[model samples]
Target: MTTMTTRTVEYPADGLTMVGHLAIPAGVGRRPAVLLGPEGPGLNDVQRRRADALAELGYVALAFDINGGRWFSDPEEMMAYIMPLLDDTERMRGIGYAALDVLRAEPRTDPDRIAAIGYGTGGAIALELGRDGVDLRAIGTINAVTTGRPGEAANIRCPVWAGVGSEDPIMPPAQREAFAAEMQAAGVDWRLVVYGGAEHAFHHPNVDHAVRPGVSHHPLHAERAWRDVVGLLAECLPVTE
Candidate 1:
């Protein structure tokens, strides 16, 4: 096993101070990197741990912030902030790009080989980055099957993978189909995995904050989704040991 180094980084985005967690592998030389986005609540310990895990796998990882280091414990408060941001495509893209720039600035990262993975609101940002035509090796989202403006998906130059829960009211069947349609229409390589009997935010365990009604954790499916995302990364951005 390789030792990993972690640190707190601060950057400006969306008119707020963004605090991100960066994890780097111990070995020398540039390595493929990943930009990690957290759920709507904000960047939490769970996401920081995920970044560390990615570093353990020999990839530089950065878990970017959404609320300037603040975590929203109230559902209504979270939505109050997230809903408007979601509606603003350019704002979301700005946040994602800011985080991407931070990751690329790390000396250990191979900027040319990078990927973006996010959950929920974070996932939407990741997709927006793809739609913005950022050069990414792969894009993976869990419980954030969203559609972008007409004809924008054509900008996505890499494969996209999305995971959703069958019982997720927030992202019901219709929404999934629409997302698939957009990807197909754009001729982009994309795939969607529906976790049977799961609900919104299925990959996230019970959080200290109050989540929406349909949001619940499915440990089994969560692990499976993690594996799927890892597989996507390994296939698209393999680490050269």
Candidate 2:
């Protein structure tokens, strides 16, 4: 069985208590930790499952919430709540940094070996954190919408691995290419993997809506992206033997 603890941490800015699941490997001492930023709206069971899986792999994982404790069963409602937060770039960056700090404060987590993994809106936040020079060991994103302002990629210091669906209309091929170019120009170590025929929100099997035109999930691609993320984490922030 995985050794994990669930708790709520208060974020003073919004006066909202964020739910988090901290999973630590059994018998491991001061292991590396991952601050997992959830998809745009909030922390869901999917993110929690990922955190649990990460903990089973011998790392302390903290899956945090940003959406003020509201779970939108309707896609429209989820977008309504998420869009506003995405528009506030500074707040998004703060959210990522705050979560990172929380993970670092944990006694079982190795502060120096900390990293981040974000999905969807959380992915953009992860990129923002890297751009702000967050001293992260590495960063990974899954189906992130790179809607932030131009030249923002120049701020990233840590290596980034971004996974996207080839058929994701929200982040089309042209946009992905431009984003990759910007990262290259910034001299940031980055890799972009496009899974053919997949769509946005591929990581979340529970997401049933087609937010983008002609886009849907691909289980095989999603699984591959998950493995790619795990491999990137291992390569960039290997656990000490």
Candidate 3:
């Protein structure tokens, strides 16, 4: 295993002080980096571990936060906060950009060779960054099948790969179709993977808090989705040893 370094980073975004986790691989020179986004509930050990795993794979990884440093355990509270932000495209873009800037500022990150992979709300932000015309190597989202403003997807400069649960009510087939249509209309390279027998946020493990209906974890699909994202990164942003 590669020796990895980890730390907490704070930055301003969306009128809140966002606290994020940063992980760097052991190597000396700059390396390809990844911007990781967590689920709507907020950043936790799950995402931090993911950053470490990415670092172990030879990439500088930043697990950015969404709700500042607060992690909402109540489903109602999580929705109350996220619903409004979801409607505000600029706000979402700002959050994503702020995290991206922090990641790029890291001495170990190769600014030109970075990718964004987010789950749920974080996934939406990644798409927003792509829509905002950021030059990303690849975009990967889990359970975030969101569409941007009219004609905005044309700004995406890299391949996009999204994974969603087949039974997810929040991102039903229609929403997925619409997202795909938007990507197609913009002529962007994109693909969607539907994990059968899974529910919303299936990539996430069962939490200690109360979750809304239609959300459950499937260990098998979660691992499969992880592999898919890793493959996407390998294809678009290879990490050299």
Candidate 4:
């Protein structure tokens, strides 16, 4: 197994001292990096472990916090905080940019070659960064295909790949259609994968969550999605040894 280094760092954003988990591969040379956004309830071990997995693949990865490093077990409480931010695009942008800055500032990160992958609310933030005109190499999202302000989609320069469960209530057929329309209208190189018989958060493993009904763990699709995202990074942000 390749050696890896992991650490926790704090940076200010959204009027809070946001904490983020950073993972870097053992090689001394700088590498292509990826920013990971956690689900709405907030950052957790799952997201941090994802950073480690990326590190194993020779990519610098940072899983940034959205709620000041707080993880919520209550669905209602999570929405109470997230719904208002949804209305304030600028605030969301501020949060995303702050974390991006941290990732770029890392010595091991190849600032110019970076990608963003997010789940749930984190996915929305990644999309927002794309919409805000960040030069991302690739964008991967799941269960968070929320569209942004009209006309802003044109700013996205990277190829976007989004996946969602067919029966996801949060990201229903209408929402997916709208997201597709926005990507098409913006002339983005985008693709949406609808996993059959899977519900929201299907890529997530079997863990305790407040809202589990609409979400599930589909091992087959989970592995498939991981491979697709890996292929994306290889194509867009190859890490040369």
Candidate 5:
């Protein structure tokens, strides 16, 4: 196995000091890169580990932050910060772009060939960036397929793949239809995967504690989701040696 390097990245966003985790693939020169986002709480070790895993696949990955360095173990605390940001498209774009800049600035990243991915609130932020007209190679989200403002989704120039658990009440059938409609109306190349028998945030392995109803970890589906996202990246943003 090839070795990879990891480091801490601190920056400012949302009037707070943000800490991001960065992973660079070994012996790289202008490799495709990805900007990863976290769930509502904030960036955590899980995201950091995901970034490292992506690096192992020969891509630079930066797990960006939301809400500075704080991870809200309390649902109310998370909602207090995330709920308002959801209503502000530009704020989300600003947050997403900050990490994009960091990723692009990396020496090993190919700026023209990049992707954005996130989970939960992080996924929403990635979608917001696409709506804001960023030229990303691809966009992938797990349980974050929130529809953008009508007509704004046309700005998304890359293929988008979204996955959600079939039983995810937070993003139930109605919401899925709405998201598909938004993508259809915009003429985007989009795909959605509904994992059967899974619940919300199924991609998160450590979400064993059901802080909120209808959210739990599905180990089998989580593995499948990872393979699906990796396939998406391979198809949309193929990195060369």
Candidate 6:
């Protein structure tokens, strides 16, 4: 079984007390660390499971909360709570940096081998961190809507992998194409994977209530996306055997 720990940490941007679930492999000595950012507000069991899975892969993973200890079953309510926070890019960067600090401070975590993975709004934050030159080894995103500000891609120094569903209305084909163009123009080592027949929030298995006509989860695509994420991380930030 993987060793796991939970703690509450204060988000510096809003001074909100947020819960963090940390999982680490047993008998570890400075293992690679990953900051797993949640989809909305704070983390839930799904995010914890992702961290646990990372631990099983021999990496120390921490899923930090952007929202306090609250979650919403209603999609509108969740969007209302999360959307206002996204307007403040500086605050988002602070949250990401604070989470990175928490992960680096862990005994079993290797600060130098750190990377980040985010979902939905969190994915934008992950990209923001990379754009701000956070010195990460790699960054990965799942169904990110925001392609970021102008000239932002040029600032990213690490390898980035972004996965999106072709059917995702939130991130349409034009947006993905533009994002790809920006990454290519910036000369950043980036890869974009458009999964066919998948939609937004595809990795979120519990998000059935928010299923729109063009937005819902597919188990097969989600599995493939998860595997691809793991493979990308392994390639960029492999754990020391």
Question: Which portions of model 4 show Cα errors greater than 4 Å?
Answer: 207-212
Model 6 misplaced regions, further than 4 Å: 1-13, 209-213
How large is the C-alpha RMSD of every model relative to the true structure? Answer: 1.4, 2.2, 1.4, 1.5, 1.2, 2.0
TM-score of 5: 0.97
lDDT of 2 at 34: 89
How would you encode candidate 1's per-residue C-alpha lDDT over 79-110 as one tens digit per residue? 99999999999999999999999999999999
Each model's total of backbone clashes: 0, 1, 0, 0, 0, 1
Worst 10 residues of 3 by lDDT: 204-213
lDDT of 3 by residue, 184-238 (tens): 9999999999999888988888742256778888999999999999999999999
Error of 5 at 129 (Å): 0.8
Off by over 4 Å in 3: 207-210
C-alpha-based local distance difference test score of model 5: 0.91
Q: Model 5 over residues 129-203: C-alpha lDDT tens digits? A: 999999999999999879888799999999999999999988999999999999999999999999998999888
TM-score on alpha carbons, each prediction: 0.97, 0.91, 0.97, 0.96, 0.97, 0.92
Instruction: Write one digit per residue (lDDT tens) for candidate 4, span 60-159.
Output: 9999999997888777898899988877889888999999999999999999999999998889999999999999999999888899999999999999
Q: Which has the better TM-score: candidate 1, or candidate 4?
A: 1
> What ranges in model 2 sit over 4 Å off?
1-10, 13-15, 145-152, 209-215
